[model samples]
Every structure is written in structure tokens, then in C-alpha cells.
Target: MDKHLTPGHVICLINPVTVNLSHNILVINCGSSSLKFAVIDPESTQVLIQGIAERLNSPDALLKVQPLGSQAIPYINHAKAMAAILASLGDIPIAGIGHRVVHGGEFFSASVLLNEDAVAKIDACRALAPLHNPAHVTGIRAAMENFPELPHVAVFDTAFHQTMPPHAYFYALPYDLYKTHQVRRYGFHGTSHRFVAEQAATLLDKPFTELQIITAHLGNGCSACAIKNGQSMDTTMGLTPLEGLAMGTRSGDVDPNLIQFLVEQTGRDIRQVTDLLNRDSGLLGLSGLSNDMRTLLEAADNGHSRAELAIDVFCYRLAKGILGLAAALDRIDALIFTGGIGENSAPIRARTLAHLKVLKPTLDHDLNSAHGRHTAGRITTTDSALTALVVPTNEELVIARETQRLLQP
Candidate 1:
């Protein structure tokens, strides 16, 4: 225990059920329409309870708890969802609360204890991440109101990539726009990227500080990170999450002039056009069917031409991003794939890796297809110069650990 801990902070040491306070940390990840919550024991890295509140603020709001069950609860807003989550936990002791905030801007480079000042800073960054930070603020306020006594910590998605050099994070836009408005690449999924990179080090039995790795988080939201010597040297998602590889609905890396061209052609307002790119483009727009990769894959297999095109574009764009990020590294050590499409889709993996012949990566078909349920290990041949792996990311665990560290006695 640290000497900084006072008697007021000793309540965290107590168990919710009067059994033994097992040091359970409650991790919350609030999205625009849903909230994912988990109670994890950091000591053993075990998840005691995990669930999601979906369709929040809508009539179809639902709460699903793993290992328990689910119910259609009327969660009018994130506050109600947080209340329901607390009620579902019964008496499980929560040593602390960890909130996943998507963008911390350039102000925060690491996780910090949540205080009024911290909340204010996060609120100030709301404009930088209009789609995410506002929802995060809502969740934070609710959690702070509900668990006023417990220590609350905020773990940012953009924190890890703060190590990127100016040349890497800066755009070609006017220097004044960057200096005045803080317009630059602030990568998302830092927790996921960092978690898998460290896990890669353990799996390969190499010093993390001596490796150059590229991590691709492929899901509804995708980004590729270039990490050198255990620090983020560069990443794909820039300023916002919409600048990386084409996501489920996001049009990644579009030309700046496209906005003006669309505005002129469609006569839609800027916000509407932005919404179209962020919510109705990518796989959904290209396939004219769904934003889900599974659905696209199925359609492609059934000879759906548009679906096939969507998948091809996704893979090609992802490969390009990976190869481009590789330039930030002196040598390629491993190319790690995580997230939904990365961990589960063998065909997607094979398609993406096919374009990376320059790295000499050889994927074992059996190993790539056999790994199930977010298992972490190599999916490439042992002799391959650049190893490929499918390491499932646990951002919640990272949040929990950060919270516990901040609250340690």
C-alpha cells in the first residue's frame, strides 16, 4: 500500500458482500448507442460479469448478461443503462470504475484519475470527437453520480499513439489549423493495439522494447498501428477514426475534395454528407446490403458481385495501410491481426496477406482457420520472416488494470 492512500479511500478495500473484497474493477465502454460493462478481477485477469446494453434510448433497448441471461429493459438513456448494470451486479464489490474515453486529444497521453478537472478536459475535447466523446461524457457523468464514493479512472483510446512523432501525426494541411485547432492524427484503439503488441512480445519471447510490430484491429471500426520499441511510431486513424481503412460504414481516406463534390451534386448539407460517410458508406454502401463482415462474406460466397467487391476493396485497402505503416519501422517483426474480422475470418486474413509478399509472410491454412473464439497465437509458418498472429484484444482488461493501478494504496 502506498502512503498516499487515506482512510477515505479505504472503502475500496471492503467487499460488496462482506466476504473478501476481491479487488473487482468495473470497466465501462460507452458507445453512441450501447454500453459494454464488465467486472474484472485484475489480480487473476478474470471477468466475473460481462454484458452489454444495446439500443439504448430506443424502445427496443435490451440488456444481455453473459453466463446469466438477457432481457428487454427500457433503458431510455445511458444513465438508466448504468443503473440497470449496477442493479444486475447485486453485491459484487467494485474497487474502482474504469471508463473508456475514445479521444483525449493532445492533452492526455496516459490514463488519469477522473476528477472534475479531468471531466472538464474531456468535455473540452468533445468537439474533436463529436461522435464518441459526448457519449463518453454522458456515461462518465452517470457513473460518477452513481458511484460517487469509488475512485473513477479514465483510459483513453488515443493515449498510446501520443508517442507518434510530429512528422507522423501531422497532416499536410495548413500549419495554423493544426496549431490553433489541434488538427492532427490522434489514433483510436490504443488500448487494443497496445494490449496485443505486449501479448505478441510474450508469445514470441522477445523483448517488447526491441521489436517493430504492426497491429491491425479489423472490425466494424478498423485501424492499423506501427509500434517500434514498445511505443506507437505511427497509426492509420487520423484526428478521427474515419481516416483509416474502410470500416463497416465509414469511408476511410476519402479525398478532401469529395465533400465539396458531393455537396454540389447531392445538394445535401455538410452534416448530412458527413453522416452518410460515417453511417451509410463503406461495406454497407458498396454492397448495398449490410455493414456486417459476416453477411458480406456470405453474400460474396453466394456469388453476390457487390459483396465480393466490398470485401476485395476492404482487403486491398487494409493491405495498403499495413504496408504503408510498415515504412515507419526499420524491420518487420510481426504483423498481428485482432478484432472481429482479423481474429475470425480466415479468408479475409488470407486475402489481406496475399498482397504482402514483400514481407515474406507465409500463412498456414490450418493454423489460420483452426484458431477459434479469440485464441491468441501465431497463424504463420515458423520459418516465415514476418510472423502473422491472431491475438484477440481485451481493451476492458486494460481499462481495469489502469483503474486498479491508479487506486492502489
Candidate 2:
């Protein structure tokens, strides 16, 4: 790492070992049974190539690539999948690699160059993120093995939120639980929030470090963040992704006693009840329809009572949550929306802003409608009190930029 580096003036240096030649970053995001990756040009933030290796170690394991198509790779594990990914790269040059690790816990506060000690620290944080951290470690090791010479960086989803104040992150639970077991509100979707916040700052023509913004990343998995002066002051999601907004299948913000209550009344075990909330609840549970927001919106328009109620609850809760996050900041410079639902769903945006009557956020209906898929910009009226936008987030691009920044010499 270089001792003298300036913001927005990062110079990608040549390494003696790998001789860094290009400015492209290979961004890898690993799930429990899938690896979604992209080759991004950090300078332009363009996705040069994108693909995924799915159902790893299963009989139906398959590898899919854009502009290349799909094919089955039998009994494909993470290492084999990584090898196939590297093999398919052909002549596209890569300067560095960026990996998305879901939970860094209290270990990493920012993106770090992957090494033995870094890997060990990441693994240690797995006690809190049992399901995600292990798979990330597997993918990191696999990528390191495949691209041994290239520098690899771990861009944590939790790293950006490590700046959160203890009062905001701590729950009302026992103090000993936080000290000993490391239990607290470690928010997710931080990468998306940070990306959109920076974009908001750019669009607002203000320094990110001086801007107070609220970002909502509402996809299948949803989370809201209150960013003050480029730092995560407070966020909705806590401990796990399941604690935030009501997601596609997650019943967010449920009663703490509901789990045991369901166990006693329904005769299901604690695990079963918990799974119900995590998997079977949310929009699907509320409407008894598909988890797809589009489907619910269409059904609601068709006079489906349950679907209408589901959409109502989703928008109400979302609006309420957004307004609630404002308490963390003195005044919000911008309330930006990103992710699938946040970016594309015009109705959701309108409905959400409608509930924010106190903020007097006037929406440009035409502008909101104009911001469909592949389009993003401000959607608030010029005279509106708040500047609300529909900024489409690119987590891979953010990871690539972070990789480039960390690779500076």
C-alpha cells in the first residue's frame, strides 16, 4: 500500500510478483451453493463479463455465463467452479480480484488485501455468520488458488457499518451477550448503501463526508441505512439480514416472543418457527401469493384483497422505516433508493413517499415513472423539501473500485 494516496486519484501500481497490467477487477460473490462473479473495468465501472456457477457439488450443478450461455459441470465444487471461471477468461486482462464477504463482524472495518492473517480473521468472524462466512472463505481460497499472483481483496458487506455508534447497533439484550458472544446489530447491504450514498453525494454536488443521506436497498433481501458524513450512523437491519424491513420471504421486525409462542401453540420446534419467519413470511406470507413484487402489484391491481393488503403493509412499513431512520440525522440531504424494488417499482416509491407526509417529499410522478429498469436519476420535484432519487446500485462496481483503491502503490 502507498503511504501518499489521494481520494479520487488512486494510481493502480504494478506489482513485482504479478506485474499488474490492466485496470480490470474480477469481482466474486459466493453464496452457500453458488458463485456469482463479474469482470469489471474499475475505471469505467463497466461489467466486461458476468457469470455464475450454481448448485455446486449437486447433481444439477451448472455454470452459466453471459454472452457465453450455460452448461452443466457435473459434481462441480467451488474450486472446480473457480478453475472453470479462470479458464473461460481467455484474453481479458485482470489487475486485481474483489470478493464480497457477508460478515466481517468486529474484525475488519474496511476492505483489506487478502492474506493468511486476513483469512484467519475472516474465519474467526464466522461464529456470528455461520451460514455465509464459511462459503466466502471457501470462495476466497479457491480464487486465491486460481489467481495466485493477482492481488485479492475482501470487500465485506459488514465493513462499512463498523463505523456505526454502539448506541445505534446495540440491542436491549444483555450486555454480556455483546461482550462475550459478539451479538449486536451488524447491518447488511452496506455495500449497496455506501455505493448509492456516494452516488447521491455526486448527484447532489456535495462532498460525501459532509452529506447526510438515507439509503434504502430494497430487493429480495432489504435493508435501510442512515449515513451521516459518509459514515453509517444507523441502519435498519441488525445482527442478521432478517432483522430489517419485511423482505420477499423474511418477516422482518417480528415480536421476540412469536417464536416460542408459535412453538407452544402450533407444536412446531423453535427452529421450525424461526424458519417460517425467515423463509415463509413477508410478502408471500402476507398475501399468500408469490414473493415477486411484480406479481403482488399486478394481483393487487386486479382487486386481490390479500395482495392489496400485502402491498399496503410493505409500503407503509417501508415509508415508516425511512422516516424513522431520519431521527439519526439532523437533516437529510437526500433520500436515495436503490436495489430492485427501490429502483424499478414506481408505485412502491410513490406509496412510500406518500406516507412520508411530514417530510413533504414531493415526487415528480413523471420522473418516477421515467426511472424504470436501466434508468436512474432524481425523482423529486425541484421545490421539494427533500431530494429523493432512484439511483440504481452496482455493488460489483463498488467492489471493483474498492479493489482498485486497495491496490494503490
Candidate 1 lDDT over 1-409, as tens digits, reads 2211111111222333443356789999888898888888877666677778889988899887764668797646889888888988877888999999999998899999999999999989989999889989999999988888899999999999999999999999899998999999999999999999999998878999998999999988999999999999999999888898999999998988999999999999899999999999999999999999999999999999999999999999999999999889998888999987888889999999898888888888888887432334788877877789888888888998999999988
Over 4 Å off in model 2, which ranges? 1-21, 372-376
Q: What is each predicted model's overall lDDT from 0 to 1?
A: 0.87, 0.86
List the pairs of residues colliding in candidate 2: none
Worst 10-residue lDDT window, candidate 2: 1-10
